[model samples]
Target: MDEFERHGIAVVEGRDAAARALRSPELTSDPGLGSPSVLLRDGDGHARVRGVLREIIATLEPFPDAVRADVETVVDALGTSFDLVRDFARPVAGLVTAAVLGVPLDDVFLDHLEATTANLDVFGGTDRQGQASAFRLSVQLSRAPAEPGSGLAALRAAHAAGRLDDDELAINPVVLAHAAYENSLNFLASAGLSLASGVARTSARDLAAEICPARYVLRFGSEGPVAISLTDGLPFGLGRHACPGSGVALAEAEIALRALADVLSGGCRVEDVRWKTHPVFRGLASARVLVSV
Candidate 1:
């Protein structure tokens, strides 16, 4: 609240007002970086890039058998005691992010992706480290060899077909990967905290609504900036800029959480729980869940 007050930004609370603010044509999601990333664009450019992304995401619509198996493998390998953020949620989220981009992401890539949260800061592109991380990821993706059916390949094809410009092609792939990873990473870790603490099992959709990891989304209007609270069952957002990868997020959570539940079914003790301080993305930084064998 002080942040908003300092910036002269309004706080759009409540489900109705937030919804209205999200849907209002008077507001725009772009934070003035002038980047080609879809998240920072509105109007036809956003739609065009978003359409390409939507098509790429469609490949995992039913949550592919391979992805499920990979998630299961990760879950099965979990030791009795592990940091849920590192051992469980991070790997699961990384795998899905890799699948989304059709490129295997390494620890470095995940580290940079995590750091890119600065790129999404509502204050705009003032975070130099965040900008550097995003730039590095863009460079890394540009040189990556993607198979024909991969998301990167699909993006290239779109560019070849003139659907996306050169700048869009270079950056949007990173944007796609970031979008797919960040919230899921946060949500999965937070949800694991709930499960480890003996909360009742809930569907992924319900859990997401409850956790609302991406706590607030910013929009600018003629008046000023407004931070809209998404905790009111608006986790995936509303209106034109709503998360394009929402379906994938839910599917990924369903599979990963189901596997996590099985691992914890024998009971567990959660310890050293910690939370990240970022006002926008809500998540745990560390939580050790010691499972009973």
Candidate 2:
């Protein structure tokens, strides 16, 4: 039993059942928190907000050569002995996210975005630090200058065109930034750890299924909060609230992991491996990869 189960939230597992539940009209993404994030609402408003985000994401559909090189650069910079989470995954994920926002994000901002994972609580905001970090990010992104045609810039344009309300404009950029950064960060580090484990190299989608970061997503039903397990291979999820950026995420992972394969090709030994205890978000806390090349 995990935190959600303890809080009387039902755990819907198995690929088939989870898929059905996810697409069911009986379940809703909104937890009644009145959060304006696209991930937290339903109906026309959800569609509208998602449409704006989808357009912004489509701009990077095939991903981009520049970002791909950035990913390779981050991985190639790895030294013989380095922490996979710190040295390999962090920079790679950070670079892609910064590209997504068209704004450079510092380590402190990324750290706060990672901490916002705790704010995904179904039990009505228990983590003070998470909430604080979220507030700080919201403030920062609201004031952050966006470049022309950037994701944030697109979002601002939507607001100007009356496609988004004030609350939606204020929060969704942070939501998008966090969404883009957190899962990729977890996925990259977990996949790096997997490669360092000497497993047979596999496709990014396959590895994404196996590693499954952002393990469970919350939905609401008559009974209350329900945690839908993604271990069933629905990593990007299903139905309306599905990760709109799945295409970008998969492409991003394929490039990063392919570049990572070369880095780990000579074989490696992993040391002091540690995993995060967060039930909903699965990832490595740290793992030292000692390259033998």
Q: Compute each candidate's TM-score over C-alphas.
A: 0.97, 0.97
lDDT of each: 0.88, 0.87
lDDT value for model 2: 0.87
Give a tens-digit lDDT track for model 1, residues 42-142: 88998999999999999889899999999999998998999989999899999999998899998999999999863356575467887789889999999
Clash counts for all predictions? 0, 0
lDDT of 1: 0.88
Against the correct fold, how does model 1 do in TM-score? 0.97
Among all candidates shown, the one with the greatest lDDT: 1
In candidate 2, clashing pairs total 0
Question: Which runs of model 1 end up more than 4 angstroms from their true locations?
Answer: 122-124
User: Which clashing pairs does model 2 show?
Assistant: none
